[model samples]
Structure formats: structure tokens, C-alpha cells
Target chain A: MRTDAAPSLAAPWRKRRTTHYRRAEAITGVLMASPWIIGFLVFVVGPMIYSLYLSMTRWDLFTPPRWIGLENYQQLLFNDPTFFQSLKITTIYAFVGVPLQVALGLVLATLLNQKIRFLSFFRSVYYLPSVIGGISVAIMFRWIFGTQFGLINSALRVIGIEGPSWLGDPNWVIVSFILMSLWGSGSSMLINLGALQNIPTELYEAADVDGAGTLAKFFRITIPMMTPVIFFNMVIGIIHALQEFVLPFVMTGGGPADASLFLVLYLYRNAFQFFQMGYASAIAWLLFFYILVLTLLIVRSSRAWVYYEGAIRGR
Target chain B: MTTLPANRSFNQSSGQLKQFLIYAVLITGAVVVAIPFAWTLSTSLKTPQQVFTFPPVWIPDPIAWWNYPEALSSQPFGRWFLNSLVIVLVSTFGTVASCSMVAFAFARLRWPGRDLCFLILLGTMMLPDQVTIIPTFILFRELGWVNTFLPLIVPAFFARNAFYVFLLRQFFMTIPLEMDDAARLDGASHFQVYLHIILPMSKPALAVAALMFAQFKWNEFLGPLIFLNRSELYTVALGLRTFVGQEYGTDWHLMMAANIVFMIPLILIFFFAQKYFIQGVVISGVKG
Candidate 1:
């Protein structure tokens, strides 16, 4: 991950004083990067330690802290039904939503890469919703998914099919979320488009001469080449989905029997709304460990499927 | 690709048919993307009765351009717009300046443990803000920053976003190292080189970072939702959320109208600086 500037010591005389001046340069580097270093220490590292401390105690805001070690974790892990509910909700969202979005993105990218007309236009329109995300989009979707008068329901009516109140139904809230997510699938589509450009035409030509059909070439060559980028998108997608907050928070408010109660939304509720700061902190640490373990496992398993062009060539 | 050896005419015909089929599918997908926004625009112009009717009114019989004014005037949206503007501008500027400086250090300057530090920085990119949300909320509350914009804006100056720094570093690395060496030889200090040389070359990357940062903060929900409790201090995003609630979900016309108005600036930015926008997404993807 660290790519340093090359050691371009042009002047021979400077080489001798390199040790002394190099230390000087290091000091300058630290100085230049002091903002981030300082920021890290304060915002990230400091708060992380505080979060761990707070997780073990019972301290609601406007009250003095009471020493209650392991209580919050025990309550969250062992007793709380909603904690398990939210975890299941979050896991289901991530597992289902990540692949669908990544696949949608790749499919969109594949089609758009075919030297199509209005290429940028397609990409832009598809990507527009993601940029305009949050409360505005939530409001728009609220109208679009309204119980009796929604756009989707109207369209469904036209086709002689009755549409459920997309956001109103507990059984359909996650499906509603997954549908809303696809509107913003352009982000990874654009990523895959960029990755697809890097795949040389010669590889396709070689496959063509071997009498590979379009589907065959896609499976054998195109997919294998795109797996690294796909994996990248999956990691980001899964993480983002696992921590999904704004849409569900604003749109569903984790309502309709907490069917859409996402983990972070539950955490936010505990911290801010319910004033269970200690419990919320415990939830935070649980999610942190959960994501860390999931990420590590995915990365470890990636060795079997993720193909690096450079690594493959080296072998 | 060059033409295959056999059935050249048949290949050409199928190719055309294949392209036609692809367009058929793509346009259908594009329609799916367009429908919600299109519906928003359409609904914004409809009368309140028109919005809730079965076999919904596709377009308003009479255009209700007054809804835009009504939406803007009915709420404290005017003030909310100013708050959002202030937040986005401050967040964007802070992000561009801080991330670029830190990126210069990571990319151009040689230091012991620089790589390790950079990795630590990248590690933060994946660390969910949720993990630290509670403690940070408390920290900000302790600072008396809860009702203010400080919680949202102050962190930007402190390099809160690791992705921006990583992005700018990727761009900074592409600038040849000799320029830094050349400046160093002329007795230009690292700060001088960063400010005078590296920054000048990094305008595009910085602009991309700024745009993405602006969009991200403009759409930000959790930070402001958690920190800013007062309706008077609410940004437009928060305003829109409350706007939906105030009517108890009855006023779709004004709500959609306001949503469109809020979307206009970002849509305009998309049309104007799409190259940078696309570049931002591509760089974030391809690099990391």
C-alpha cells in the first residue's frame, strides 16, 4: 500500500550527507503529515479507546458513569432479542445485497462497454441517484413506494398486478432496500468499466481464434480478469451494506415491527434516542469485531478465486 | 476485434442483431433508473389529489409551478439551504487542503515508518464510523459542539476521510519524483515544494476530491442527525427529512418539488464536471 518516491539521488555530493539530511527529510514528512497523525491520534485512536472503556460501563448522558463490567456485552449478546434481530437483518442485507449490486454493476458495465450509443449518458443517469443520496432520495423513494399511491404500485396496477406497499410491509422492507440499492449500482458499474478497459483485446482475439463463443470468452477470460475488481467491489459493497444506516433510518425508521432494523440504525438508536450509550458502545465494538473477522475471512478465501494478473503471470 | 475466418456475412448480421439486443436490454435498464426521478418531477407538478389517485396521473393536467415556491416558502428551507451550503463548502475545502498535504508527505517525502503509517491510515478507511460513533458523539458533546457544525466540519480539517488522502496519494505518486528532487536541489523546502510544485500539478485530483467530499457531506445524514439537534441548525438534508414528517406523509407535491430543487445543484455539477466525477469513482475503485 505504501508507494514511496524513488530514491533519485542525482547529485553524488548529496549522497554522503544523505544520512543527516534524510533524517531531516523524515522530520519534514512527519510535519507535513502531522495533521493526519494528530487527527488519527485524536479522532480515531483516542475515540476507539474511549469506546472500549464506555462499552464496559453504564453511563447514560447527563449522568455519572457506574462501573458495570461485562454487563452491556452480556445483555447485548445473551439477552437482547433486538440485537440478534438486527444482526440477522444486517447479515441478510449484506449477504444478499452485496452480490446483487456487484453483479448488476458488472452486467451494466459489460453492456455499456460494447461501444454502445449514449455510453456516458447511460452511466451518468444510472449513477445520478447515488450522488443525490440521503434524505432527498429517501423522500423521493417514500413517495415512489407510498402505500396506496406509489409509482411502482401504479405501474404494477397497469400490468394487472397488485403491488404491496413496498416500504410499509414488514415482509417487503428488505426487498425495498435491495431495490433502492440497485438505483445506485452505477458506482461499481463505472468501476468495472474502468477495469474492463484494462483487459487487452488480444486476449479476446486469442480466445476467438480458439473458437470460444461470446459466453465462453466471457466466462473464461472476461470474468477471471474482472474478478479482482469484482472482489474489490464486493468488499466495499458488503461493508457498506453491513453498515447501512441513512436509508433505513430515514425511510423505514427501522419500523413495521423492526423488520428493517439495521445494526447501525439500532446502534444509533441505542446511543442517541434510547440514551443507552454504554450499550451502544458495546454494539459498536461488536460490529467492529464482526466486520474485521468477516473481512479477514473473505480476504483469506479470496486466494482461491481472486486472480491478480501480475500474480498469475509470475506463476 | 478482427473478423472471424468463416461465415463473415452471417457473423456481421448476428453482430448487428447482438448489438440491437444489447441496446434493448440496456435501454430497459436505463428506463428503470430514470423512472423514480421522472416520477418525482412529474409528481412535483401534480396537484395533491393527482398524486394519490389510482391509475396515477402521469402528468399534471395543469402545471403547478407554484409548488416550488410553496415548498421553499412553507418551511425554513431557505435557512436550511444556507446551513447546507456552509457545511459543504467548509467540509470540501478542509478535505482538499488537509488530504492533499498529507498525501504529499505520504507520496513525495521519504520517512522512516512512512509505509507503516500510510497502511495504518488506509486501515481507517475500512473502519466503520459506527465503531467510534458513540464515543465521538460523547467527545463532541463534551466539547459543547453537539448543537453546532463543529462535529461535522472540524473532523474534515483533521483528515477524517482516509479515502481522500489515499486518492490524492495515488495521483501524487504519478507525478515524477524528480520534480521534488529538483525543487529540493534549489533549496525549496518540503512545504514549499508541496505548496508551489505538487499542489499546482494536483488541481484536478484536488477538485475531484472536493466534489466527492461536497456530495458526500451534502447527502450526509448520520453525522448531522446525531450532532445537530436543533431544527434551527438543521441542514437541507435534515430539513427534507423533517419536511416529510411535518405533513405526516400527505404532502407529496411540495416534498417532491423540494427534493428536485435540492437535486438541481448536484445534477448541474454532474453535467459540468462529469469528467472529474467519473475520474473520482474510477480512481477510488482502480487504486484501492
Candidate 2:
């Protein structure tokens, strides 16, 4: 919303002055923006181009990078089982975990949206887990999912039921992470809450006058109105879940025969652990491609599902 | 008339039942959510024997306050805490200052390619950090900046955070243009106007950005995990991870103690500055 100093047509000198002012403003603007511009060049664009090049080459940290055209990509696609395994694992995690997280968030948000006492208290209690960093949460969950003395098992034992070793079992490892993911859905819940509040109560009131039941009003009005925010949360959540590294790294170490081996964790192992810079770069690019394609697909699908209140009002 | 009154009474009773049900569900969910934290705190104060007891001791009879000091002493937690403080503070300060400046340029200034630059910035946000991790590491290694805080700290000074910049720009747009025009008329330079008029007026938004950035930096793991190999240079997150890894058949009590210690500052920040946190989340959510 910047206003330019337009050159005055009537006064020749004023026009010159205006041009000078405009020039100065532009210079100042560039000066102010230079930090980010320089950063983008040195950090973002430069690394991206170099990484694309690196993806085709073979390099360990000690050796000079050997350029081999599309070998890394070919090996990753046709040769490596781990590559496909990591891809499948990450896909399932993001797709399954994000929807569950979004649904739970919506449910919690809907519950809290009622005219209630201690609204902030309930919100804070529920949202508290999300801000606690990943490592600590992972650490906490390692204990909570512990086989013998863990929180869940101990609770189960009281009812005479034995609990599974969550992190130890290959099948249960992903399930454990999924459960852990639920704890942090508070962030999405906050987002869902914000969307819920913005929804006009008049819609519900109008539904009430038409003799609609609670479920009908909710599904018909609230869910439709909330679709945009849900779409946003899903896109953000899926992208984030796809990059799940820290929890698996710290807790499971992508263990139980790579059951929890996420794409980024595998990428990290290749890059840092094995020091295969070139191959790791290939994995990174593949992960990026998946995220890009998934995000695009979601954005494309949003037209059918997402509801903008303004669109209806404008009509 | 009699039937109408009966129907009104039934509606009133049903409304009351609905309110009760809502409360019941909310309270039950809240308790379930809070249990892990309560378990952690309970474990932090328990003896090792108590930690493994069946039916799991919910409360310790004699609380072990010594666990905090004992766990902290086991690792170079003091050094790690200081390292984290330095990184989080320096980077957070840089993020707030640089982001606000860049945001001002985007929100208020007229320039060639300004809109394009902003669009590029938004585009970069979608590009996952993993995409550039390899080459960025190589670049840092070439510069001999690997195993140092430079990789973590330098980016903030250059407005590497597109989200913060976007947030601040959204805020800056809300400040009336008349204020800037008035400041300019009074012979204030663009920088002067940003410093005096915009920055001061944007305290709330600035505070939101700073708090969120600090939280992110303090919790950051991946950067330190990859860059800093030296134990002495470990941040709290990395240090805690190492602490957990160092011992086999991990001491649950000590681990819980360490976890709680790591979490206290963030918890305190949340309780005190929750309004900003919620506002930041809501703004990012609703707008993005």
C-alpha cells in the first residue's frame, strides 16, 4: 500500500523534485530489503542450485565430488529398497497422522466452542503440549510408551490387560509415533478454534429456525465454514509430518528394522552418518518433489472442498 | 397451555443436560491430555524403585528434589544451557530486528521488483529446509563454519525467516500511511520513520515474533544435531538427547528430571505470554 510521489505536470521543478524523492524512496526500499535479498542469494537459491547438481554426483566428505549423470536418481528409484521403504513410511505417516491430528483438533475445537466456563483454561491445558519442543516430547513419550513401567502399560495393568512394547515392535512403532503426533495436535486445535470463532453464529441460528438438529447444523454449517482452515492445517500438517526427523532420531533412532525410518531421518543418516553428500542430496530432492506434488494436489483439490464465507456472501 | 409449559420445561432440561455433557467431555479430555505431564512431574520426584513399581506410583511419598541437581550434574547441562541461551537470544533479537526492517520495506516502501521479491519469499517458505540441507552443509563446510553456532545464528540476522517477515509485514500494513507521510514531512528518513514510528507502534506484533522465534530456536534440534559434533558446544536439546543416549537401560527418573528442566522455561513463557502465542497462531492460521 505504498504511495508514490507522482511527478507534477503543472510545475517542471516540482516534477524534478518528485522524481528525486521517488528515487530516494526506491533506494531506501532496496537498502532495507538487501538483507533478505543477500540471504536468499547466498542461502536459498545458491544451495538449491548446488544441491540439484550434487544430487547427480557421488561424494563423501573426504573425497572430491565425482559427477555421474542421473546415477544417484537411477539408483534411488530402481536399485534401493530403503528409498522406497522410507518413501512409503513417510507417506503413510503424513497421510494417516495429519488427518487424525486434524480430526482430533476439530473435535476438541468444537467441544471448546460451546459457551463454557474456564475456556482459556481448557485451551491452555490442551495446547500446552505443542509448544514443548520435539526432543523433550519424544523423551517423554519414550517413557510413556515403555514396555514395563510405562504410563500406558501401567494403566492397562490395573485393568488386567498387558500392553504391547510400542517402540520395540515394528508394527507398533509407527502407531506409537501416530499417538505422539496426537499430543501436539494442540497447535492445529488452536488454529481450528480461531476458525470456529470467526464463523458467524447467524448460520447456526438460521439453521435452528429451520428445525435442524445439532449434528445437522454442525455438519452442514460449521464443517463447511471450517473447510478452508482445515485445508490449511492439512497442507501444513502433512508437510511437517513428512519431515518427521527429531522424534524418530532421538527416541527410536529409526529402529525396529527401520519401521519408523522417515524420509528425512534416512536422508540425515546418508548425509551426516554415511557422509554421502551426493546421494543424500538425491533423497532430499525426492522428499522435496513429494512435498511439492502433494501440496499442489491438495491446492487443486481445495476448490471442490474449501468454502469461503465471502464467496457465498458475494453471490 | 398445559402442554406448552410441559414442552418448555423439557427443552430447559435438555439444554441443561447438553451443558453437563459438554463439561463432562471437556473435563475428561483435559485430564487425559494433562496426564503425561503429571506423570513426568511425578516421575521426576520419584526414587528409581518407585519409577518401576507396578500400578506406577502416581505420587511419591518422599519427593526426590535431589534428582534435578543429580541429573544436571551428570551432563554439562550448565554449559549446554548457556550455549542455548546465547543462540536463542542472539538469533531471536536478530530475527525481530531484521524481519521488521525487511517487513517495512515490503509493507510500506515503493520499489521496483518489491512485489516479486515478496512473492519469492513466500515461495521459499514452501521449499522445505530439507531440500537445501545438503548443499547448505557443504557451503558451511567450505567456509569452515561447520561445528560452530554460525550456521544457526547467521541466518537470523539476514531475515531467513519468511514467516516472521510475512507476519510483521501483515502488521505493518495495518499502520496508517498518514503516520508515515507525517513523519516524512517532518524530515524523517525512511529508516528514521521505521525506527521511530513503525517499530514502536508495532511492539505487540514484534513481541509476538520475538516470543515465537525464541521458542523455535530454543527447541531447534536438527541444525545443532548436524552442525555441532563437539559435546562442549551442545545446545540444551542436543545435550539432553546425548544425555538420554549415554546410559543404557535409561534412568527414567533422571531422564524425566532432565526433560522437565528443559521444559520449564518454555512452560513459564507460555503461562506468562500466552496471549501473544495464541495471537501468533491465529494470525498465521487464518491468514496463511
Question: Which predicted model would earn the best DockQ?
Answer: 1
CAPRI class assigned to model 1: medium
Off by over 4 Å in 2: A1-17, A312-315, B1-6, B245-248
Candidates in order, TM-scores: namely 0.96, 0.95
Pairs of residues clashing in candidate 1: none
lDDT of 1 by residue, B1-288 (tens): 224436878788878878988989888998998888889999899888777788887779889889999999998888999999999999889988999999888887777778789889989999999999888888898889989999999989988899999999989878877787788889998899999999998889998999998988888888888898898899888878766662245688888898998898889888899999999999888767
Worst 10 residues of 2 chain B by lDDT: B1-10
Interface root-mean-square deviation, each candidate: 3.1, 5.2
Model 1 TM-score, all chains together = 0.96
lDDT of 2 at B48: 80
